[model samples]
Target: MKDEKFNILLADDDPDDRMFFQDALDELSIQATLSEVTNGSDLMKFLENNLNKLPDVLFLDLNMPSKSGMECLSEIKKHEKLSQIPVLIYSTSANPEVVEILYNMGALYYIRKEGDFSCLKAVIGKALFLCRNTRLIQPERPDFLILVDDIRPKLPL
Candidate 1:
């Protein structure tokens, strides 16, 4: 299948981390338009500014200065147009509770921040794949990030 183009919104406080992920995405040859926001309030402003366009995927950092990732995810999920977009919690925190909570809140996946490109590639690959499929309704299992070979359940949209 031909790959579809997409716009990815990354909300993270750390510039270095953002660049790392961007590099990984570039290496993967994934066609995407990346937009970044440093904090939750900035993310909200970004969403407002891009009034007509909703991001295909959102990579949200759990902790931020003004508004936390949790807050941003909650706010986005509450909105009709935004709720349909996939939100992935990207963070340094490996806390299971955080993952569970976000998953239940409709996050597509909760992936921990890794120090290298290979790890980043896995996350990016999963995100790109998820974006390609329109069937997924609720957030997928956290293990989906680890189980790359399994067939994803086809959601009836």
Candidate 2:
């Protein structure tokens, strides 16, 4: 499994944020293939069309043009075929109330988008590592929100 490439799907409307995510992933030591969709509707279409090959992990943004990430998350969790895939909420805002709601909605993790490249790399790396090593289950509230600056000690890649 170490040599196998992970499939990652990101649904973000912001072009700059998408580019930043790709750049950060490119710098990581892990081997991964990233697919992007501009909005929630496109994301659902992609997932529905690729049922046989769903991404290992989904990095979903909260805000979008069409359906919101919260809506997508709910739809995914309710769908039998899509429920198993782990979803990590990737957004700029980290409101405590919203985080709590997302957690209850079955989001595997919540990662606050950072401006620094290093922080982005670190958080992305950590998220990928966890998704690979841990079971696809929602963690406790304490471990649900992944803060870029809160990260300490190098995670094993």
Q: What lDDT does each candidate get? A: 0.76, 0.92
Hey, what RMSD does candidate 1 come out at? Answer: 5.2
Q: What is candidate 2's lDDT per residue for 1-157, written digit by digit as tens?
A: 3458999999999999999999999998889999999999999999999999999999999999899999999999999999988999999999999999999999999999989888888999889888888776788899999976567466532
TM-score of each: 0.85, 0.95
Ten consecutive residues with minimal summed lDDT in candidate 1? 148-157
Worst 10 residues of 2 by lDDT: 148-157
**Which lDDT tens digits does candidate 1 get at residues 78-122?**
987778777878888777777778888888777777776676676
Q: How much is the lDDT of residue 62 in candidate 1?
A: 89
lDDT of 1 at 98: 74
Off-target runs (Cα >4 Å) in candidate 2 are: 1-3, 152-157
Residue 144, candidate 2: C-alpha displacement in angstroms: 0.3
